[model samples]
Target: MLRSLLPIVEHAVKGPVWDCQMCGQCVLHETGMTCPMTCPKTLRNGPCGGVAVDGACEVKPEMQCVWVKANHRAENLPLLPQSWRDEIGHLRAPVNNSLAGDSSWMNLVSGADRKTPTGWKGSE
Candidate 1:
């Protein structure tokens, strides 16, 4: 019951605020509270080297690059802790497609996001 409702509630809260894609393993804290999944290219690591001089996204000239916003917020957001600001440069794990639409809250409690996904090492 709760397992089914978690995703719905999570989406309801995160969707409009972060343009959440329900990637299930959220790195918002790591990425300055910005959702990299919302990027047009969904480039998890960083920008695609196409950011304009004015800080606009290459894919969408009018929109600011997600990484740019992430880095800026990571550094300048007064509410963020020093540790979170320092984490913007860390390399993040690739998206776990199997976890899509699942509840990250549950994954965090279960430590499911920490374990290597099945078949990532070898046959499950």
Candidate 2:
């Protein structure tokens, strides 16, 4: 199917370079529409001091901070359980390689192998 072939074609032409938005919607929406995975700072309760009055991130001035965006989304939806929100605050995963190498998108489309763990030592 073309879906499966597209990644291979892209990889062949472009190597492994890809862009990631790092939106935690996948984890947030299902659990309670709360995103912890995407936000680099991983703020649960609210936006950190980095948030500008207009709701832009200090780190990436052009972009709306993840926490600011998440807060807005959460406010529109029903209130999420405090425990679920709290749990996300502590959970952190390396956003890039984690998705690129291991995502089901790559698995189904490209049949790419998961990236070797950091500092892995193969036996001779």
Candidate 3:
């Protein structure tokens, strides 16, 4: 019951504002409120090298590069807590496919989202 309902509520609240993709491991607080999962390439850490010189997305030329926007927001967005913005430089772990469609709010509280497969390069 907890798992099933959390996703619906999470999506309903976050979807309209952030266009969240419910990757089951949310890093929006660290990401300047942008949803990295919504990137055309779904890049977790940062933007692809294909970003144009003008800061436009290479995959979707009309839009600004997601990372470019994230960085700007992380620095300039008012009312962002300093601790949440401090992690912008961290290397986000790769997506855990098994957790797709699950509730990230629950995963976050239980620390389930941080579990990497054995031998994963991101594992400590």
Which structure is stronger by lDDT: 1 or 3? 3
Which rank order by TM-score, best down to worst? Answer: 3, 1, 2
Tens digits of per-residue lDDT for model 1 on 1-104?
99999999999999999999998888898898999998999988878889999999999898999999999888888789888888778766668788899999
lDDT of 3 at 74: 92
How do the residues 1-124 of candidate 2 rate in per-residue lDDT, one tens digit apiece?
Answer: 7555754564443332222233311245322354444456654344678778888877778877776666555445556666654444443333334444233444435433333358655333
For candidate 1, the TM-score is 0.89
* Candidate 3 wrongly placed segments (more than 4 Å): 121-124
Badly placed stretches (over 4 Å) of model 1 are 117-124
Report the error of model 2 at residue 64, Å.
2.5
> How well does candidate 1 match the true structure, expressed as C-alpha RMSD?
3.9
Question: Which clashing pairs does model 2 show?
Answer: none
What lDDT is reached at residue 115 by model 3?
A: 93
- Cα lDDT tens digits, model 3, 5-115, are 999999999999999898999999999999888789999898889999999999999999999999999998999999878988788778998888988989999999999
RMSD of each: 3.9, 9.4, 1.6
